[model samples]
Target: MVMQERAVRTRAALIRAAAEEMDRWGYEGATLTRICATASVSMGALTFHFSTKDELAQAVQESGGAYMTDLVDGVAARGRPALRSVVDLTVGLARLLQDEVVVRSAARLTRERPDGHSWTLFWLPAVRDLLQKAADQGQLRRPGEPRAVAALAVYLMAGAEARCRAMIGAGGGGDRDVAEEMDLIWELTLEGVAAGSG
Candidate 1:
């Protein structure tokens, strides 16, 4: 039990360190040696836990996805999430990326390198659920295909993420406005490019 506990602790430490290195220097540029150093774990320990740098990158992504998912879930668990929740999710994620070392690194790291197929598995089902609920509530137009609409919603959220990153990078003026614009964009990217003419 003690050994297992230590292993878990080691794994968490390594993931945290890898996230730091991955953010400052993308996956390729982040070396195992550097990660080990940041983690203060021996090279052998890193090798024991993660076979390769790619593996470490994958671990970081998994951690990031979990971290982000929990953040969204936490907010939603407080109430029935809204279109406002979607907006808050993206903006909150961007804020997390700007601040949280682990998640921030995970943000750019996943894009920097596509290691395993874990990302799709981790996110898809939740996205499908979100889409189905939005459609049922009439908060979203009935998409021709829920799966395709879910995918598009993910794409739109990515754009919102980029906007937040850009704004944060530029020193954070007008974040509320940018967030509002993102909310508008998400609303617009729905069933028909054209709205009802009535």
Candidate 2:
């Protein structure tokens, strides 16, 4: 039992170290030696957890996807109005990307893997579903245009993710205040979509 527990901890540490390394350097630039050194683990230990750099990268992406899935699920559970939920979800994801190295690395990895699943695959459908619900409930000013609203929401979130990546690369940290920027974008979007807001 103790051995298993130690292995679990070691694997988690390796994943985190790999995330940090991949976040700093793209997948092609990140190396197993550096990942092992960062994790303070031996090559054998890393090999035990992940047999190859590709496997490690896949693990990182899966971890990130799971985190994002939870975030979206939590927001959906709140039963907030659809527009509000969309805004909150986008902001929540931006915050996750900014604060979590694993998430940031996963985003980078997703971009690098042409065959990998897109992060939008997780949330875009939710966004579309919510917009449809909002339209059904008469929450939207232009009830006939849920598709357009959904596209807009996706574009905004994608843009925010890109900007966050740029900020990280520039070593600006979280100084950009992504949440506030998201709020402003939401406000502008709501003005166009909210019912009777003229």
What overall lDDT goes with each candidate model? 0.69, 0.86
> Model 1, range 77-182, lDDT digits (tens) per residue?
7565544455556555655655566776666775677543433344456567766776667675454456676666577656755765676567767636554665
Q: Deviation in angstroms for 81 in model 2?
A: 1.0
Among all candidates shown, the one with the greatest TM-score:
2
For model 2, state the Cα shift of residue 193 in Å: 11
TM-score of candidate 1 versus the correct structure, residues matched by position: 0.65
Off by over 4 Å in 2: 192-197
After superposition, the stretches of candidate 1 with alpha carbons farther than 4 Å from their true spots are 1-7, 112-115, 118-125, 141-152, 163-198
Residue 79 in model 1: lDDT: 65
Question: Model 1, poorest ten-residue lDDT window?
Answer: 115-124
Clashing pairs in 1: none
lDDT digits (tens) for residues 1-198 of candidate 2? 999999999999999999999988989999999999999999999998899899999999888888889999999899898878988888998888878889888988888875777778867888888889999999988999999988887788778778887886687765567777988878877776567767
